[model samples]
Every structure is written in structure tokens, then in C-alpha cells.
Target: MIWETLVEPFAAYGFMRRALVGCIAVSLGATPIGVFLLLRRMSLTGDAMAHAILPGAAVGYLIAGLSLTAMTVGGLIAGMAVALFSGFVSRVTPLREDASLAAFYLISLAAGVLIVSIRGSNVDLMHVLFGTVLALDDAALILLCVVASITVIAVALLFRPLVLECADPQFLRTVSGLSAVTHFTFLALAVLNLVGGFHAFGTLMIVGIMILPAAAARFWSVSVGGMIVVAAHIAVSASVAGLLFSYHHSLPSGPAIILAAGVAYALSLVIGPVGGLARQIPSRPRTQL
Candidate 1:
């Protein structure tokens, strides 16, 4: 049966199991961080950080081979560098955050491509760009789990301050001693999560996976915490559906996964009860006397 072809391989292959696990792990780490980034209006920074990881990953592959540990370490380093540099530029110059982020992405992408081309040979640039989840190894799965766990814990501990600062930085400054330092620290952790998911989801699709679910959740909830929970659920559901579809249909996993999220986003945009397209449409006013 066609269904058996889809279900059987996942049961038969450990790689498939690992791939599924990795997707779940990425969802856990990325979804909450995505919500915060969206609130901060730093969504583009997340995208840049995702692309910035490529050069580090390529360097890691060149030096230590294609091991997951090497690539992850490289990615983390590169992501942090980009995030820090962006922050520094924003603080020191008149350029805005989005402009700086745009510059960072282009430079990082060009650097990554140049490095990969020079190092050359067996590297699959497309894989780095789009990801291939079915090829995940046990080691990569474990790394994903570890990174997800850390991210969850970090977010949970900082939830209150982060939320307060995100919604009203000036209010937090007036009430508490929250500084730019704390803001930078939170951004750093977000960059880490984005980089952590890069290998599994790729630069091209990471922004969609990170932001779309959170954006969708915003339509369904008024409370920030509630939105985060909803976003996580949305992300997990999309990942599972995409994984299944890819398994059955022989499609690339990243695009399938992003497409699934995109559908959710579109649905939320149109039919979501609150602040959705339906609600945003100005009701026809009765003619006033």
C-alpha cells in the first residue's frame, strides 16, 4: 500500500527516526525564540544569523570533516560573531537594525560561498542552503536535543525580564536596572538557537520555520505566553506533517516543512478570528444622518 511505503521506512531506518527527532528538537528551541524575535522586530536578524552560520560550518567541514559537532561549533561561533557585529554597528552608527542585518546577510553569504568554492570538491552547497533532514545522523540528532534543551531552559529562566524588556524597554529601564547588556545577551541566545537549527533546516527556510508559526500564534492569542505555547504547537505539527509528506512523496524536507508552515501562516492571515484579514477589513459603516 502507498501508506505502508511512507510508514515502513521510518520504522525501518534509524536515520528517519533521528530526522524526526531533530525536527522536533529544532521546533522546541526555535519557536519560542522566534516569538521573542518577532516581538523585538529583529526577525531579519534571525535570518542573517542563519545565513552567517554557513561560513563557519564550511570552515568546520574543511578542517575537521563533516561531523555534526564540528559544523555545529563552527556555526555557533559564526552566528555569535554576526550577532555581535550587528549589535555593535547599530550602537555605534546611525544605521538601523534592519539595514545592518541586510548588510550582514549579504556579506556572510558571499563569504560562505567564496570559502566553499575555494575549499571545493565534495561539499554540497545546496544541502547547506536547503537542508536534507533524512540524512541526519544519530550524532546530529543528539546535538539537536542538547541545543533544544538548553534553549528551553534559558528562555524559561529569562521569560519575565525578556518579555518585559521586549514589550517595553523604556518601562523596564525606568523600573528595573535592565541595561543594553541584558538585551544583547538575549539576542545572543537567540542567535545560538538560530544557528543550532541551521544544519537541520538550512538558511533558506529557517526564517519561515522560525517566524511563521509565531506569527500565526499571534492571531490566536492576546497573551504573549499563550502565543508562545501556541506557536510551539504549530511548529511541531508542521514539522511532523512535513516530515511525513517528504517521506511518502520523495520531496526535499526543508521546503516541505516550510511550505507546511507557510500554509498555517496563510490560514491565520485569512481566517484567524482576531486581527485576521476578516477582522482587519473595515466593516461597511451605516450611513450617518
Candidate 2:
């Protein structure tokens, strides 16, 4: 029975399989990074970096003529450069991290729009903004696999330093030297995942998938490891369910997946018994009323 449903769809159409696999791969790559981003209070940076890749993707499409490999590389490079430059500017100047991030994203957004306008038509712009998951080919799949593996390995190896930096940057810096490299590496991995997910979910909604599930998982778990595990599971489940829903209903998979993640986030915000909004609300109400 399971084979019957999957066989017809998976065998009949390669795009379906690619989309499914790519979604799952992105979740695995992104969820842990999201956890650290939240812990470090850089949640907004994730959103900013995701958007910052748009121009790079557009430029890649223009130069390489719509090749996914080129687009992914372009996005990765652009994201890393943005991360480095923002950090440098913030460190050297009086501007805060948030200010630096805002500048970076605005510049990238304008550049992306201008470049796409000059080099390609509206269809190319649509593909960059809305994405083309159904258009993914073998090369993109291979790139996703490589990126996912690197993300997993990077997370496993740097988990301790990353956590220390996120939870207590001052203490970590004082005791074990500045964890700047680890922090940058973490951001780089996150940007790569965002690029990959851009192809799956587009720039506008990638942050919803990257941060929402991880944020939701935090409400359910006190331990960081537990949160990471739960977040990854939530992301994978949402992706699979969203894909199935999109296939049956003829909806766009990216938005469907993001909505599913948003639901999970909402559920976590309200329903988790310990530290959830439900628990916090009643105590405050009892005091006031």
C-alpha cells in the first residue's frame, strides 16, 4: 500500500522525488543552525542573510544561464561576504549589529532587483523570488547532499563552542579566547543552508522554515540538544507533509511547508505546558484579576 502511492508518483515524475529529498535535506541542514541563531539573539540576522542572497542568485542565473549549481555557489559566496563585511563594519564603527545587518540586506535587495532587471526578464525574477523547486535537476540534488553533509559535520564538531558563544559570549571569550572563527563558521553554514532552501522555499519564506521550528522546539525542551533534535524532527515532518499537501491540492510547496512550520511554532507558543504562553498567561492573569 505504501509502495503503491509512492511508486506511481516517485517513479512517474522525477521532480516530485527531487523536491521531497531536497526539502528533507534542507531541514536537516538548517534546523540546528537555527537553534544557535536564536540562542545568540541573531534571529533577525538569519532573516537578513536569507534575503541578502537574492542578488547573488540572480547574478548567477544571468551569468550561468539558470544553472542551479552556479546559483547556489553565487548565493553562498554572497552570504559569506555579507556576514564578514557586516561583522567588520559593526566592530569597527559605532553601528550595532542590527544596523549593520539592515544595511547589508537593503543593499543586497536593491542590487538583486537592479541586476535581474538589467539582465533578465520578469520570469527570471519570479524564479528568484518564488523559487522553482519543480525545476531542480541532478546537479542541484548533488549540491544539496554535499551541503547537508557539511552542515551536519560542522554542527557536530563545533557544537560546544557554538553553544558557549551563543549562551555566554563574554564568558567564552574571557575563558577560552574569542570564539569568533566558530561563530563565523556557524554563520557560513547557515548561509549555505539558506541558499539551498532558497531553491526549495524562496528567500521570503526560508527564514520561516529555518527559525520557526527551532523557536517552537525551545518551548518544549530545556536542554539544547533536545531542542535541536526536536526542531529537526519538526522541520522534516513539516516538509514531508507540506509536499504531500501541495501534490494533492496543486498548491505551491514552499508556502505550504512554511505554513506547516508556522503551525508548529504557534502550537509551541500556546500549548507547551511548562514554559508556554498558556502557562505564563494564567499566572499573570491571576495576579492582575
Candidate 3:
């Protein structure tokens, strides 16, 4: 039973191995960014950026149908542009960061859908919108690994600045001259990771993998480091479980992975140690009226 269920699937298939590797790389790199986004109260930023990539990927589709390089490059360019512009607005303009992101997301998403409808059929649109994880080539795998590694190292280097900025942006702005630099740099890194992740997980569902694990971890841990660790574990678990389920059931690989993550978040909401529903028992007795 074990051999048929676990060993045979990955052992017999090469794509399964690649999918797992890419998912791990994505989980390790993107989950931590989600944690920071949550910490900074910018969780929607991930969604906005994910939507922002749609226009670029659609443009790439318009140029070259189903071309991996074109789509990746286009998505990267679009995601980065939105990230920088939003950061600039947050720093210089009176409008809030979330406001700027929301505006950009709506415009970008509409433009993308319109562009895709211009020359593509519903099948092409579906393919572009929800990418196939099981079809990853060697180049995609390499890019995923490299981006993941760079994100891990960069996050380590920027740990203190990020925490300080998240805790008190005003203080960090006044005390450290690198607050803007730190903020923009982190956003760039996040965009980069999102671009890489969306290539494998699809633009629509990649943010789920990024955000849900971190959300679940919040219910399990109070410390930033602990949350990151827990988030990574949950993400990896979801990836593996989702892949196995997809393999056995012939399901859409990307959604399967994210659905597994959703399950984890749901379970954590009930049973996690820190703030889970199960732990919300009353500690004080009610006074009789």
C-alpha cells in the first residue's frame, strides 16, 4: 500500500520530482515574504501584485502563444513596475500604499483580460490564467531554484530593517536613512518571487500558496522567526500532499496544491496553539446577572 501510494508515484515519474522541487523552492522563498506582508499589514499587496502580472502575461501571450520565456519576462516586467510605482506612491504621495495597490490591481486586471480576449480563445485564456505545474522544463526549474535562494539570503540580510520598518515605519524612517531603500528592495524581491511562483502555480492561485501558509502560521506562533518556520513547514506539507492528490486523481496541479494549503489554514484556524478557535476557551467566569 505504501509503495503504491507514495513510492510509485514519484519514483515512476520525472515531472512529479520537478514539481515537488519547484514547489519547495516557492514555499521556502515566498512563504516568508507572505509573513512579512502580514506583519506590515499589507497582505493584499500580494494579491495586487499577482493581478498586476496578468496584463504582462497576456501581452506576452499576444506576442507569442504559450511561450514560456515571453510570459515569464512579460510577467516579471509588469509585476516589478507595479511594485516600484506603489512604493513610490506610498513614500511620496499622500495616498496610502493599499489604496495605490488597489487602483493598480483593478486597472491591470481589466487590461489583461481585455488583451487576452483580443486574439485568444477561452482555452488560451485558461492556460495563461492557470499555468500547468506538471509541465515545467529545466530552465523554469533552474530559475525557480535561483530566485528562491536569492530570496532566502536577501531576507536574512534585511531581517532587522524589515522588522523595524514593520514595527514602526516612522521610527525607521527617521532613524535609518535606508528605510525607503529597504522597503523598495523588499517589494522588488517579493515581486521577483511572485513572478517565479506564478509561472508554476498560476497567477490566480500562487498568492494562495504565499498567503495561506503565513496566515495559518499566525495562529500557531507569535514570534516572526517561529512563524516563518511554521509557514514553511505548512507550505511544504501542502505542496507534497497536493501533488500526490493530483497525481492520483488527475486533477489540476496548481489548484490542487493551493487547495491543500487552504485545508492547512482551515485546520490551523481551529487547532493551532497560539490563537486557534479551540484555544479560545474562556479563562474567566461569567458574573450572574
Q: Taking the candidates one at a time, how many backbone clashes does each contain?
A: 0, 0, 0
lDDT of each: 0.81, 0.84, 0.89
Model 3 Cα shift for residue 231 (angstroms): 0.6
Candidate 3 C-alpha error for residue 37, in Å? 0.7
Over the stretch 1-289, how does candidate 2's per-residue lDDT look in tens digits? 7765545566777788898788788888889989888988889899889888988887898798777878888898888888777778889999998988888888888888788888788887777877766777777777777778999998999988988888888898888864888887888898988898787677777888789889999899998899989999999888877777777789988888888998998999899765898889769967886
Candidate 1 vs candidate 2: which has greater lDDT? 2
* Top TM-score model: 3
In candidate 3, what are the lDDT values of residues 1-289, reduced to their tens digit? 9898977888899999988999999999999899998898788988999999999988998899878788888998999898777778889999988888899899998898899999999877776677768888898898889989999999999998998999899999888898988998889888888888877887888889899999999999989999999999999999999999999998988899899999999999999998787877553243332
Cα lDDT for residue 261, candidate 2: 90
Segments of candidate 3 deviating more than 4 angstroms: 87-100, 284-289
Q: For residue 240, what is the lDDT in candidate 1? A: 78
C-alpha RMSD for every candidate: 2.4, 2.5, 2.4
Superposition-based RMSD of candidate 2 using all C-alpha atoms, in angstroms: 2.5
Report the poorest 10 consecutive residues by lDDT, candidate 2: 1-10
